[model samples]
Target chain A: MDYTKQIQEIATRLFAEDKIDVFVGYRLTGFDDNQVPALIRESKDVPLLVFNQKSVFNLSNYLKNDHTRNKRVGLVVKGCDSRSLNLLLTESQVKREKLYVVGIACEGVVDDAGQKMQNCLECMVPAAVVYDELLGEANMERRFIINADIQDMAAKELVQRREYFEEVFENCIRCNACRHSCPLCYCAKCCIDQETATLYNGANTTSSAFHALMTWSLHLAGRCVDCRNCEKACPSHLPLHLFHKWNERVIYENFQEHLAGVHEGDRGAFYKYSMQDPDDFIM
Target chain B: METVTNQLVSIEKPEIVAPPDWQPVIIGILCNWCSYAGSDLTGTSRLQYPPNIRIIRVPCSSRVDTWFLIKSLQTTADGVLVSGCHPGDCHYISGNYFARRRFLVTKKLLNFVGFHENRIQFSWVSAAEGPKFAKVVSKVTEDIKKLGPLHLYKKENFEK
Candidate 1:
């Protein structure tokens, strides 16, 4: 599971071969074993490219930033990050030819608590969906499981469910960390921004959080790769994953078991249609 | 528990029936080419439909952002109905096709979160089928009437 030395080797080779303009990976945060995503521009910095359980941030987000835009990128992706990479390619947010992806067949990463992340626990795609080279063994046999939290939420009464979300919303400080951390939230000017919003303004009201979170979750309904970046970014530690996983579960059930980023070049759920799509709820 | 008692207090019979002259506010986001034109045809043909819905005509059904529907439900509307051209018949080729997928996910997610699914609805009504448009409206109104007020995130006007 320690791919740090291998990542450094590959990054050095890619740099020597002139295969990439930049390498996006992780470096240890100062004073901690935890890693912070590092964008290595020169070959000398390739040694900073490390991959282990603490390599948590999804590097595909940097592809949208100015640092890697239009530059040939050699990047590392865990199971979930690769799916988002597939989506980024599909959405034309990043050109596939420009990316030299080093995929990881993840054995699940741990949180700060050293506990396995819920996303990794239920991960069906333990192998990178798209990559130039792969590390670790692919477990294609892993079955997809609906998150237990979603099942528990579904069993609650309507009022109880509302109350649960109210608590989640009330705790939100309206910091927009979840939105900023989301790789798919690549909009130059997000509608959730108070200055550009037509619905809810920038105020940190509970109602604004309700609107922003609902809008944010809906936008990611078919595209979220369950990277947990949004949840991790939230200072309130809002179960932001619940909003997303709830949407994912509903889309999975209603949209012919459609899972995002599993297949390369797959259009988002809302970008395609099927004859069998459920419409009984339609008038 | 405190919540259990609160729920008991809130569950009084909600006067399910809409009083006479009390029309349910249903916001209808209709695509200009199909559902809106079809609604117009209903007027031209003197065909009657429930007057409860307030139509906001967009260039295409795809233009109806899910947030707009959610906003309507949270603000004033008791129900939201989004109508578009039949699949493959969108004025903007694949607009309704994409809209179909978006609406389906939004509807399912809202329902899963305990918002009554019946409050928001979707349908395909062509411009030629004025009667079909009327039928859809009648059915949507009836369903919303049964559900009564949504009582979601009603906020007072800020600046506008």
Candidate 2:
């Protein structure tokens, strides 16, 4: 779980060889145990790059930023971050030849309170799926466990669930942080931000929040890697994973347990269809 | 004269829901080649069906974005019906197949967020199936009616 020296050495080597113009990794926040992602452009700053249990922010998201865009970049990735990176690769958002990836066989990153995040506990792929050089023992055990919160919500009555979600959406401030934080939502002009559309017209109303979040979730339905970037980015700290986990569970059961970006060049479930897809649900 | 006016009004708007007359507005987004043409056939065949549905045509089932469904439910729709070609029958060869995956996920996601599972439904209707189209509409209308009016995420309720 501690690869600080190894990562520093790797970044030093990558920079010394002029292999990458940018190295996206983590650095101490100087405030707490939490680490902030740092984009190191010079080898002199390579000493600042750190990787440990507290490196919670998915660094792959930095690849989509201007610091790494169109630049020869090297970045760190955990199991889930690597999956989202694989999606970004499959969608042709980033050219593979232009980047070098340092993968970590993730032991799960911890939150500010130092507890392992929920997704990592249920993580099936603890090793980087797509990587040049992998660190730590690669364990790709596939564990499928439905989250308890989803089960509890499903058991509630329709009225109860509706009221709960209404309050959740009503509290939304429509900041669009979640969209920017997601690596897969790379469109230059997002549909949710369309001013012409009266529904998601950048309003802070519950109706707009419902539209924006629902549309955003559907866009990431089969592709979401449970990275929790959107949840982490939300200022309100809305439990945004509910939308993603529900879709993930449904896609898994209905589409033969298809996980996003598990295999190279594999598209999301929505992109590829099977004749075996459940048809009884459709009248 | 009063009886004559009343009968005339009823005949002109025969599709109106009876009794309380508060018909649930269902949005029907039909793919151009199959479902839309099938609806056209239903019209030409003069088949009687519920008028609660408001049909919007698209190039194919895959052309219908997930936002379309969400926007409808947010704006004025009580329920949504997305109809495309049958499996292996998409004019675009695999449009409906891809769309089918999205529909199932979107339907379930909306349902998971507390919308009724029946609030959004999907179907496959070919151009030749005029009677089948009517049957599907009536079934969806009836299902939505029984579920009552959709108040979830409506702008009127939450507008500032």
Candidate 3:
């Protein structure tokens, strides 16, 4: 769904009516057709809002940033991005009343190479679960399917699997772009940061990568919405989805087939329990 | 005690044979309110379990970070076990309930990444279940022994 025209009109109306103090959307990156997130504070910038295939960044990451905090804001979100926003509301990180949400019924966003991103291909919900005004037609037939890569990883031997992740970890520079780009990693002072972490010296070692990424993924176990922001931000091109999809797949299997951020006020898998929860793994 | 003697005599060897004297270094992260108290009860009651497990008591099993489990496996530990209060019985009221979900995901992830699920174990041993605690420890110890040493995540020569 090409929503460039509709987004421009909505932003203009929201600004003209003074319904929002700031309107967050995407603008042309100036050099390419690809879009970059733009925070427009004035009515004049309303025309810059655009939503197209290249609008891939989950704009919800900006909700916790300094620019949008405590402001009456307007923002656009795709299916996965809306889920993150839903989680932010449930986690008390963002107030739903202070913002206007323009939700999009996404038709699988494509990469720069024009192929459907892996997360989009596996997406089960293509419509926003929470939105003040939803755009586009919802595709109701998609079902939650495990990613092909995860299925392949499951078939490998134990040593082979360890060797694969070893390579993935070795290439990591510990730059933490993945953590910074993640919407759920909104901690004021992240524990994985070397200065604050008491458990392990935050170094660029492979061991540190294992520690940091494992902690990061575990924290996002029941919360990640597969926005793919972390994967897109990684400089090493490491398949960070392996960690998240692993957690997502496991939680789906063991915790009442739970999916993250699909509803308002959902407390996630770890925060709540059911007596029917699988205990065969426990002794 | 009698339970410990029986476990020592009934130990099973894995398909891959190693030296008879090599014992797995198992790290047990036990919750203070239940599993740790249960272990204490085992000692006081003279119930015997394997001595290979080194216990670390945490406020709750949920406090056992996934990093700690992974780091233990990568470092000195040959196997890891996390024991907590039974579901709905956490001292902190829902700490173990949450831990059950966390442990399930952690175990599945480890197994997906080539670590055998047997290398790590999760159990609930209530404060009064001294015999049950002994049985769990012995069972986990024997399982680890049968799988031999866990060299999968060890730091030495892992760079390759």
Per-residue lDDT of candidate 2, residues A93-179 (tens digit) = 889898889999998888878898999888868799988899988866666564767777776766677779988998889999999
Candidate order by decreasing lDDT: 2, 3, 1
Worst window of 10 by summed lDDT in candidate 2 chain A: A139-148
Q: What is the lDDT of candidate 2?
A: 0.85
Q: How does chain B score by TM in each prediction?
A: 0.84, 0.86, 0.87
Candidate 3, residues A1-283: lDDT per residue as tens digits? 6999999899989988889988889999989898889999998877787888889999999999888999999989989999999999999999999999999999888898999888988997888878899898765557557577877776666667777998887898889899899998999988886575643454466766776778888889999999999988898999999888878877776666788998889967788987777788899
RMSD of 2: 8.4
Per-residue lDDT tens digits for candidate 1, residues A1-283, read 7999889999999999999999999999889899899999999887777789888899888899888998999999988999888888887899989889999999889999899888988987888878889998866558567488877777676667767876787788888888889888898888877576755665566667778888889989888989999888889889989878877777776677788999877977887887787666565
**Best candidate per lDDT, number?**
2
What is the C-alpha lDDT profile of model 1 across B1-160, one tens digit per residue?
0111112112223324556766789999999999998999999999999999999999998998989987887678999999999877988888977787788777766665557667788998899999999999999998887777666555543223
Interface RMSD after interface superposition, model 3: 9.1
Best prediction by TM-score: 2
Task: Give model 3's DockQ, 2 decimals.
Answer: 0.31
Q: After superposition, how far is residue A18 of candidate 3 from its true place, in Å?
A: 1.8
